[model samples]
Target chain A: MGSGSGVSCAVTLNTSLTPEQRALYQDVGQINHLLDSARTIALVGLSSDRQKASFFVAGYLKDEGYRIVPVNPKADIILGEKVYPDVASIPFPVDIVDIFRPAQEIDGIVDQAIARKEKGIDSPAIWMQLRLVNLAAAERSLAAGLTTIVDKCVKMEHGRYRGGLHFAGMNTEIISARKRKR
Target chain B: MTHRPGPRKFGFETRMVHAGHVPDAHTGSRAVPIHLTTSYVFDSPEYAAQLFELKQYGNIYTRISNPTTAVLEERLASLEGATGALVVSSGMAAQFVALMTLLSPGDEVVASSHLYGGTVTQLKQTLLKLSIKVTLVDPHNDAAWEQAITKKTRALYGETIGNPRGSVLDLEKLSRLANVHKIPLIVDNTFATPYLCRPIEWGATIVLHSATKFIGGHGSAIAGVILDSGNFDFSRFPAIAAPSPSYHNLRFFDTFGHYGFLMKARAETVRDVGACVSPMNSFLILQGLETLSLRMDRHVGNAQQIARYLEQHEQVAWVSYAGLPSHADHALAQKYLPKGPGAVFSFGLKGEGAEVREDGKKFIESLQLFSHLANVGDVRSLVIHPASTTHQQLTEEELAACGVGPEMIRLSIGLENVEDLLWDLDQAFHALSRSIRA
Candidate 1:
């Protein structure tokens, strides 16, 4: 297990350590494994305004091969995907639920995810958009035996982990070469 | 010390902080004061007549010009190495004024295929509705522009560093192409402010900025500025040079001499459209411009660093930044934007397969530090997933044409410490790793 300084997994461990924890651990593990296997994303908060961070990051992630799912109340559909008001409303089983809403609204979203989890719908993970504060809810989901990640940007992570950082438009091949060795 | 030239010849930094501004003439105030008044009273009827009839040039009305805004225009012009500039309400207005001044009904404009969504809509939809024809060309291909030109084409338009994709245009080639055809080359330098790349220096006759982005730095103000190089010989383009009914048979070239284009744009297009920059916004933009050179350096540095970090990550699929040597336009970027390609870049992620629970979208949803908003150019870092957001209106084929794919992610690096940014990224990937393990 990685060090849990910024995030605490204890709250999760205390609530569900039975077969469910192992099952969830396995489930999240498989989801990440599948992400390694596939390439496409559907971001919900993708906006068109350049002033909006969602606009650029979504574009970045799309450039990375993740089929983006832009979900916004104002936009009918984005990146060719029919944007839904909520995850449960989506017709398809998405691998991830990237939330770009405010921190306060995350609890209800987590509740929706929980409802879906109860209905035998197995989502791989619940990824919150950056700065989407919901530490308690993230812990609750983790306790429920689901994989939870927070406080990070999906685009930056993919770039750093997938060896895409070599394309910084400068001579940084040596750094990436070293990183690959790790 | 006695023999050394003062801050005038120091460097870009010193000039940005001090150029075109001195203590207030009346109060001896060292700082540029925000002159909020709407109109400057004339001393007498003769003075007002002189100001109105162009016998002299001074503040007549805030609608026409303001002292605070003048400082900003002068500073921007100096930075861009241009002879004159006009500050406007927003970058969009600046573009509108530029177009309105140069193009009449039935005239044509040759523009790049890869442009801001708003700009594309304006040219294809709004401008078309106005009876102005627009020819779209893939800026990547030099020949496409050559083939699109017509006798009615008045100007060639493009962005210095294309938005979203970060594709760098070869300004020298486009400028040469325009020159050969006797048309003006207008560039939107919003992405790459003069601090990074000055289009005017690269043969662009006119340059426009959103100023709302890095220029404002804080994302608090919406404003724009147009800089005229005053290098183009308008006489060669008789239509623009020979003005008539719009301004009382006054031939711009014959009267205004060097600052003809800028003067005409302000006097006519902006006057009618009423897209003048508000004094408050102008003051905000001026404050932002003072630190532009400094902020831009850090923005580029951090972006380069973060882009490199993301490109090497195991979960990433592809990366696109002109600063990246492997990028298709790296050579062009080197030639045009040698001072470091603008801060924004794009990348993609490896999505999960059916057996895995979280898909690529899930991975994005999992991140924590990055803010998922619709705006960019803030002091803080920003991120977005494009296929589903900014370009949602476009179809798959359209997205592909714009170089956007399913897993693509765009990142606009901020001025934060690079290490902290990387650490935040590292945690997100670790979560991804953990999720995959289950």
Candidate 2:
């Protein structure tokens, strides 16, 4: 198995998780694969306010050499990237659609993602930000053969595997005894 | 054949080697690079403002964080099972920064009487200058510890294995006391080095290490680290939960959650104190950490043999190593430090007052292999007379309280061959006897 981020995906799961939950939310290997494979990410609900988590994560992703498309109806540009009102409106191919909207709003956004795929646009993976889980919509996206992530922070995952989150005293949960491979 | 999922938790040995670093993305260098630069470039004016305002996490200057030092912090944190760690200039700086961040002028601390001489001075003398009073108590007296906790008391402090005398602390009991009193239990785990024991696993909220010791394995680097378990609820603790005018009313606990204390220590305390560890020292310490377990196993094995040999000698009055069955804290040692209570300990010589002190000096000088030095945790064995050197600043009563006596000769066992070390000790004992006869 290839871990493009150089972080081991082996993880102990909480006993409370079901088989479906294990394959979906807890597959760190898949998360690593997506992070490594995706080059262009479209961040839905990207805010113009600097203090917002969405804005902070978008800026971090942009800095890490990822092409970020800001999808906000209110903004023209964010973090020096052009803003599109929705995922479908973006002219270029998008590998991931990261949603920072509320839990209730995930279905509408997933609908837009599905419509884009049906129209022969790129089959973009759906990512719901931290604490924004929509299992029903996630199931629909999964049925349409699109990778889906829920209730996770994209920036934190990126930082966790790439050896960045520990700087602020956060636990990265990576335990290996060998020096990181070259 | 059924597919089996690999074990989720990596072993300690594996983590020691690999936990804190990844290959350099640009150059593919497997080893940790010494980032010798003082400052990092900002992408834009707006980005610079965000970093300065603590709205984002990125390198601003080496004083706060360096790529090399960050690996040391993360690696140590991984070993200790702590949420995060901060590296400082020296062991004293780690303790000072931790206390300064956790306390105000009127706050108080309850610490163990059994501690390194330098730590005792920092607690009793220096902290007093800041109006923070520290009351030393018998670590064995559970009642004394609880009685010392007043409303003004902010932390309970102790060492995992006490210096010189080798008294093992009852971390679980003290942690429970701290929990009831709503204070944090801060432990100096310099002696145990997370290989033998992790104070955080028992209940400590914070752990401090003089990485100058076993963490470095070799005596090449002088550095320290402070680790936070992130288990303490700082919601009511004003030092962390309250807003700070220094950073335009930023509340650490509210802003960073579990990472609040260390982030404040690094951004505010270390930034102002300028007590930052250099990237070169970090690289050296990292090299030492790679072979920490290997060195410690030999150190412990050699120490057990030496302590046993010393106990049976006719000129030796008593041995204070917790690994010995006759030791007072031997049971506690088994509980806290199952891999033996470290290699450094103290022993008394057979004689009365003035004669015994003379014998100690003679014995240390006669040893061919053991170097006479003040520092411990070196790869080479070291000997010191505590009453005349390390603990000489303390008065008689203070010296008695700390279990240091005129006849006390402290030994920091090294990774030398046990047979060679025993032969050296045998010759030193004979030399002392011959001197007394003359």
TM-score of predicted chain B versus true chain B for each candidate? 0.92, 0.99
| Candidate No. with top TM-score | 2
Grade the docking of candidate 1: incorrect
Q: Candidate 1's error at B392, in angstroms?
A: 3.4
What proportion of true contacts does candidate 1 retain? 0.00
Candidate 2 local lDDT, B1-438, one digit each (tens): 997864267778877987777555457667888899899998888778868877667789999998899889988988898878999999999999999999999999999999999999999999999999999999999989988989999999999999879999999999999999999999999998999999998999999999999999788899999999887888899998888778777777755556779889999999988899998999999999989888889889999999999999988999999999999999999999998899999899988799788889899889999999888999999999999999888778778888999889999999888899999999998898899889
Which candidate tops DockQ?
2
What TM value does chain A in model 1 reach? 0.68
lDDT of 1 by residue, B269-341 (tens): 7778889888788788878888997898899898888888878988887788989887888998888888888
Every model's DockQ:
0.01, 0.25
Assign candidate 2 its CAPRI class: acceptable
What's the true lDDT of residue B134 in model 1? Answer: 88
